[model samples]
Target chain A: MSVVRITTLSKSISNLFKSLVSPLALNSFFVLLITLNISAQDVDIAKGKSLYNANCASCHKLNKKLIGPALKGVSAKYDKEWLYAWIKNSAAMIKAGDEQAIAIYEEYNKVAMNAFPQLSNEDIDNILAYTDYVPEPVATSTTVSGAQSSTGEPSLANDIILGLLIVVLLVLVTMLYLVTKTLTSIAEKNGIKIDQPKSEPFSIWKAFIKNQFLIFSSVVLLLLSSAYFAYGYMMQIGVDQGYMPVQPIHYSHKIHSGANQIECQYCHSSARVSKHSGIPSLNVCMNCHENIAEYNGEEDLEKGYTKEFYTNEIKKLYKAVGWNEETQSYTGDTEPVKWVRIHNLPDFVYFNHAQHVSVAGVDCNKCHGPVEEMEILYQYSSLTMGWCIDCHRDSNVKVKDNEYYTKIHEELSKKYGVEELTIAQMGGLECGKCHY
Target chain B: MKKITFFSVMILMSFLTLSCFDQSKPNYQFFPNMYESVGYSTYQESDAFANGIEAQLPVDGTISRGWVPYDYPDTNEGYELAKKELLSPLEVNDENLSKGKELYNIYCAVCHGSKGDGQGILMKREKFLGIPSYADRDITEGSTYHVLMYGRNLMGSHASQVNAEERWQISQYVISLREKLIK
Candidate 1:
């Protein structure tokens, strides 16, 4: 009876251990799978978010119905296939007399949803998947906690370890030096002749003066330094790399480009066709600022001296155009916003924004280094002839489907036997192309 | 060796000073009386004078300054390219459209309608009839450019009030608003 009881107790204990280990292991495995899935989903969601913000956010909202219907339960409301078809070309669907599409079209007072044939099925799926994700209450709190702890602990620990390692390395090097010095001193004491002089160490300057080899090297160094200085001075004669000047208005590209995501072309529309990506006029501001009297963002509000970012900037514009913003009407005492032009090319050099932006299809970011990311707009690219030539030499023109380049692409392909044609190959680097 | 080095240093200093003095004078100083130096009267009697003396004469003392003329090769090509590359000139948000509509109603609705239908109060009152809806006009980028440059029949030149690029933007916005109306 005693043996049986002991055996039963042992069995129960083992079972308890098994139960504990199994769930813990299972929980970790589940967590690993979940983390991987969540990250992958997050990447797609991020892409969808950007796409939504760019194309759809202007008309549609997630929770609230704006110009279009609320998109909160859009995934559940329509099947994936139907949603894809509707989003791609709503007008087509309506024309085909699709009941659901026609009903939505009528419901929205027949405000036509802009066709997005460019959007792919995968993109729509990702957008739908993003919408379907529902955050758990506990998960939200844990994420916040995790973010705080991770941000603080990892960086602090990394800094501490780096500091400790540096100190240890320094101590080790010092000890090694000391050991060598001690060994050398001991050898000297034992009447072993050392190759190095026992005389007091001379400073580099003194040595340079006394030693003929050092003197020759110093002369060479001096000559090289002068040559380098002369070359650098000539190269940077008009190159204003860090040229930040006070503008007529404190127009922050950080605010407009970075925060607001105002496309560069919105103001610099001339970039497409004309040589200059021209600065926008007061009327352009009036188009929007006529309604957006105030900026909603906090950063703009705090640093923005004149009530609103646009209002203050518009005030500067008003001063240029002689229009007053205070009374909600034009006072007609305007001055042109004499914005100090940042990028100035040499008289001989010719640069065209249209050629780069329109013909070459080079992203503004390629030359401007993510102007949208900058707070205070600064000249990002060197805008040098060499820089332009280098890019032209490297960058292949987007010739496919471009009606303008179709004929050129064919002729070039036949000549070179290689389909790829760089801008340089297409006369981008010619002296006349840049200079004339 | 010391004597030779000292003499060389002196020569170098004198050369530097001489070069500095030479550079101090302006480029035009060589020809103080450029008209007299060129012998303007003698050139006038020459057979080349028949074409125009103004063309023969060198540009007075002022440097050419190498001003590159702003070349807009093809206006139509430019507008099409701009449309493809540039963001919309007007921010077409709800607030912007609302303000645009309001402005259109106040300033433009007398001729162009609240919905830009070309049937404003002015048209109803018969003040100006046949104000074409923007959509009805088979407007290319060039046609818009032309209209903006030189005003049409009744509409006076808005070029004075609006700058060159703003006209393009207004044209773009007008086209967009027209699109909205037709739809």
Candidate 2:
């Protein structure tokens, strides 16, 4: 009986060990799987960095505020889902009477946060992840100075490589020429007889008449050259791509658009609705210059008329509009500001600023090529038919959740099976759309 | 054979050279005016009158060489179609609206109210009354466009404060706010 009991007890102990060990192993396997999934879903830090610079870096610092609240610890304050919702549509949430949102709104003295509904959930997640995983801050001056020094690294390396390549190519060509010359001289010195080339059996005129291939090639070359020249001539027939004219006043787009970040609409207010982005009159300048009275930049100051320069420009506007700054009133001697218009399309062609700016949702930078970045805003795009059509062909229309395009969306889906609909697909390139 | 070949080559080169040579200078064309054409004794003569008319008639000859006629039709349908297809400019999107609203409140809310109710401090202070609530007006895209173009009532034209499209966008936002208020 005791022997039997000992065997049974040993079996039971072994069974218990088996059950415990099996569960632990399974548990570890699941834990490993979960960890892998989380890592896979973790935000891409690189993308986050770029998105931050493009959108958020202008206003908010990681640890301090420039224009908006510091974004650091923002991820900790809100859950991922809440943060995404808040970032995407903060105003809407506040309007919907979310208490937390309202408190934040009130705390900021009702200064509304800009809505970013266009941002995908993934993008917001990435931004949040970036905020959460703050790398230790490097010393600002060191990094900035280091960046300045490193700026020339790529260009310097490229120059050195290019110079070396040219030298090597020159040496190779020289060697080949020298070798050929030496061989020819050696052959001549050895008195090796070389045959003179055979002449054509026919007369020169007759030979030219007989050579069909040569004739055909000559005709083809002529036609090709003519066609190439004609094509270039036709392309530039109406397009004033780099038409930088001397303006009546030396208004620098580079100053206003580029450095100040004063919006294009600040001056060209008519872009949204009118066919023309009407040049702002002198009165518009008076709106701001009335108060500013001086150019704050060192360059403007160095140009001798620091105080008198702006005063003179304002006076010019005053002369146009007949305003007296001393009286802070209109003198009625106002002459209309004769702003030399830029970006002139042909009279035959009709271009509307409103359509591009307001409806299709293209940024001025897309066509104007970073006017804010320009010192003197020149016409960046060719503003040609081909250029317009090419953009229409490539650029996708902004149609996400827009009620204005609900019918269009339905029709487009039916026609193209819900593929990405570009502007060209929407008859943007139709001749009547532009030419008329 | 060599001499013949050389002579033919020379002839062919000469033919190529001769084809491009134009010795004559281009003549400047002079077009006389109709009045000049009917000059001297016939200048003052008129078919309607039996006797001599005015001594000189206005000359008509120097027509604009570069002038091209406007080709597009200007009918109502054409205008409407053009307006719909090419003129209905886009406004600020959700992204820009947020930014616009932020900008608006900073600059405009002091006078226009957060809701654009026109009950802003200026209104409250009795400085500027009758600042219309966007809802109160029968504002279409066109009418809204007109008001923005030429300032209505007491408010001066905001042409300076915003660009044309931005004003339109602000109009869109105002319309949107109006819709919200109605809701």
Candidate 3:
């Protein structure tokens, strides 16, 4: 029996050793092959990348369809000679009735590719090499995401500890209850009474009714509270301070303004010259969205704003804008994105955005709050008459370099006997300034 | 016992009142007629227009106030012709250059770096790629204006955001940036 066991054990050990060594040897061989392959094409790819970025990147992307077709593995699809001729002058080939050229021209809505007579055959070969080059994903990235989860482990631990505490407390309470029951039963068996306080029936309401001072005080307190509540209810009637309506599109101001650091006036261009800060038309969106088709930004997975979720939102934008991504052309079918307006002043009030934004040079954040930080935009202020007046009273008027305001500012400063003048002092409080 | 019940009821009432403030909906208006405009406000949905929207596009042939007609077409040949012939009406002055710089910082600097080195924030972030430096491209004032009027390649037309004067101002600034880069 001992001999048989020893033979089987040796066989199992050899099997385990072979299993380990075979995979290790194979992995090293593949790694060596990949590294050699990369080194061989590295120089060509480096040059090709710069050339491709300069000449081709404006219209073409590596994998995704842009204004032109995807350039990844493009060499496999067409002959090198044909690619060379087409790259130099695609229009000439289409005119010459080349079948492949014509097919491409027709496929891409007849948009002629820009002729690059500068690029030689070697340059073209390098570009193709660059297109074919795919970098292996680093193992460290998974470890980094793993590290992020480990950082989050503290909160998970805290939750578990709290749950354990609750369970412990529950157990202790039940045990205490059981102990008390047994003790009471033993007391009853031993003919010993725990408590026997004999008293007449009592009613809290009756006692409270008998107390005149308490009743009077309670009535006054009730009246005061009711009046306070009523005042609060009336004051907030038209406020809408935190109105955050769901927009047709989930356009995160946080992503655009905060993370991207885009200036407020980039989209709200009208704020510089007009009374209203007009909503940017769809073309403004197309300016960036045409190129940035995917969402590769940071995500709040807990909030369900995942990578896929943001990408879906981008798709919704494309759908509303009627852009055919495959053809890279407008379909002439668009539905309006009805963005819910958050800050709406009363009709009587005349709030000029240019006055605040351009003339006064007030920061957009001064009124709009930290709009960049807000994931879902809501009214930061009450937008009430009192709120406007309060700002006008406190904030100094910005007059420097403003030709329109210079004269008024000088006169107002002289009249007020101060170097600086508040907007309220400069006739901002005048009824006719806002209301006719 | 009665007092506890009474106090709980009051607490519940307060909670209900507080919870009634739904953020998704507008608050109760004192007078909606006073708050809302009688006249058609900008971007308002209405029955007056066939499209049922207040913000309508200008008629196909009609020109709004202060609009200068651009003669150049959007074709590549038009781009070449415009590059050679289009001249800036605005003189190269400090005021114009400064205004141009300001406008460029707002509109162009996001993609076309402030120094026109093609290292703008967007380019650095890799959102946009292969933006040529101002010095790299042999662009004149006219070509710049034409490109601004009708955007070439990946760029969209900025005409809607800026007026003709602003475009010329931006072009002047861009030329200045190119000169600085060349130096």
Per lDDT, the best of the predicted structures is 3
Better by TM-score, candidate 3 or 1: 3
Runs in model 3 lying further than 4 Å from the true structure = A1-42, A78-123, A136-226, B47-50
Task: List model 2 lDDT by residue over B63-158, tens digit each.
Answer: 344332222243333333433444326654895566556545534554467797766664454333345566654455544444444443223346
Rank by DockQ, highest first: 3, 2, 1
Question: Following a full C-alpha superposition, what root-mean-square deviation does model 1 have from the true structure?
Answer: 20.5
**Most accurate candidate by DockQ:** 3
lDDT of each: 0.62, 0.62, 0.90
Task: Let me know the DockQ for model 3.
Answer: 0.68
Task: Give each prediction's root-mean-square deviation over alpha carbons.
Answer: 20.5, 22.8, 6.2
What are the per-residue Cα lDDT tens digits for candidate 1 across A304-390? 443455556655655666644443446766544546666655545567788777677778888778677665567777777688788
Listing candidates in order, what is each one's chain A TM-score?
A: 0.51, 0.48, 0.77
Native contacts kept, each candidate: 0.00, 0.02, 0.73
In model 1, where do residues sit more than 4 Å from their true spots? A1-210, A300-314, A325-327, B1-183
Per-residue lDDT for A229 in model 1? 63
Error of 3 at A383 (Å): 1.6
Write candidate 3's Cα lDDT for B129-161 as tens digits. 888889878899999999999998899999989
